[model samples]
Target: MALGSLSHGFSDWAPGHAATANHAPPKEMSEEFGRAAEAILIALESLRSSVDLAELQREYLTFIQIILNEGLGSVLRGR
Candidate 1:
């Protein structure tokens, strides 16, 4: 909850942060990531709203990895 500590925590994505000086992803790639992230959220929301959707086959193990690495990655790669 401390302000000073937050700098380190948010260094990566915070706009204009020194830590992201040259480490930031390219704009095109980041924009694609943004789209993919949004898609993942929409997928989860759809599942949550469906009465009988039940659980999703979230790949081998990790949730984000399934959505981001596989589905989204394939979708974005086509673009």
Candidate 2:
């Protein structure tokens, strides 16, 4: 997989170029992906109720959308 799209989950977390810079993404991604997912899992576990998790979920989706759109725009612009 390309650095840009590497993720354990369907969600892509790391920025493409940065993800590739440190090492080939797939190798680095396993560790990095787990850490990010674990952090969110921990946050959900800490939450008092499902509502809190839902709120986090919304925010996370929005964040991912923004990243994806930016990446797409950059690509369209030939960057």
Candidate 3:
């Protein structure tokens, strides 16, 4: 997605096709998002060493939940 669209999505937590006012993210929030992205990438890369399929899948889902429920949730709430 375009950066502007992504920023607006985060601001409103609405579908891309929905009409909502677009607002630029603050610099601190943008920096936090960059850090979060980097951390997620590093975690995924580290998962390559896992030797068990079921365990890896479980861990991946947990990671996804943490990102969606906690990480993004906090960002969206401006907490």
Candidate 4:
């Protein structure tokens, strides 16, 4: 998905922003977020910083951990 498509209006970002009362956003949104997450991970891996290599590894792992802990099945379910 294009990065431009990710920018939603204010209401779109609000809690329970779904077609109905659902815990997860729509599948499309989740997929888009997945793409965005990958892009972020790539940057986190490639960029150099004064921060220790261990810190960057922690950041990368933490990002994946957040998504997995949430449960991918729940995250992609459509409202």
Looking at model 1, the pairs that clash are none
- Please provide, for model 1 over 1-79, each residue's C-alpha lDDT reduced to its tens digit, 9 standing for 90 to 100: 1222222232144334587546644456544545544565565666666544333323211333422343345477895
- In terms of lDDT, the best-performing candidate is 2
Candidate 2 Cα outliers beyond 4 Å, as residue runs: 1-25, 55-79
lDDT of prediction 2: 0.49
lDDT of candidates 1 onward, in order:
0.42, 0.49, 0.47, 0.48
**Candidate 2 residue pairs in backbone clash:** none
Better of 1 and 4 by lDDT: 4
What TM value does model 1 have?
Answer: 0.37
Ranking by lDDT: 2, 4, 3, 1
lDDT of 4 by residue, 13-48 (tens): 223336533544455665555666676556656764
RMSD (Å) per prediction: 12.2, 10.3, 12.0, 7.2
Score residue 56 of candidate 1 by CA lDDT: 36
Q: Candidate 4 at residue 7, lDDT?
A: 35
Put down candidate 2 lDDT per residue, 5-79, tens digits, no spaces: 333244344455675444433434345544555566566676737785677656654544434544455568999
The TM-scores of all predictions, comma-separated, are 0.37, 0.34, 0.37, 0.41
Task: Give the lowest summed-lDDT range of ten residues in model 4.
Answer: 4-13
What tens digits encode model 3's per-residue C-alpha lDDT throughout 1-79?
1322243335432223345324334546646556654555566566756656345445444433433443455679998
Q: Which ten-residue region of model 2 has the weakest summed lDDT?
A: 1-10
- Candidate 4 ranges beyond 4 A from true positions: 1-21, 52-71, 74-79
Cα error of candidate 4 at position 23, Å: 3.4
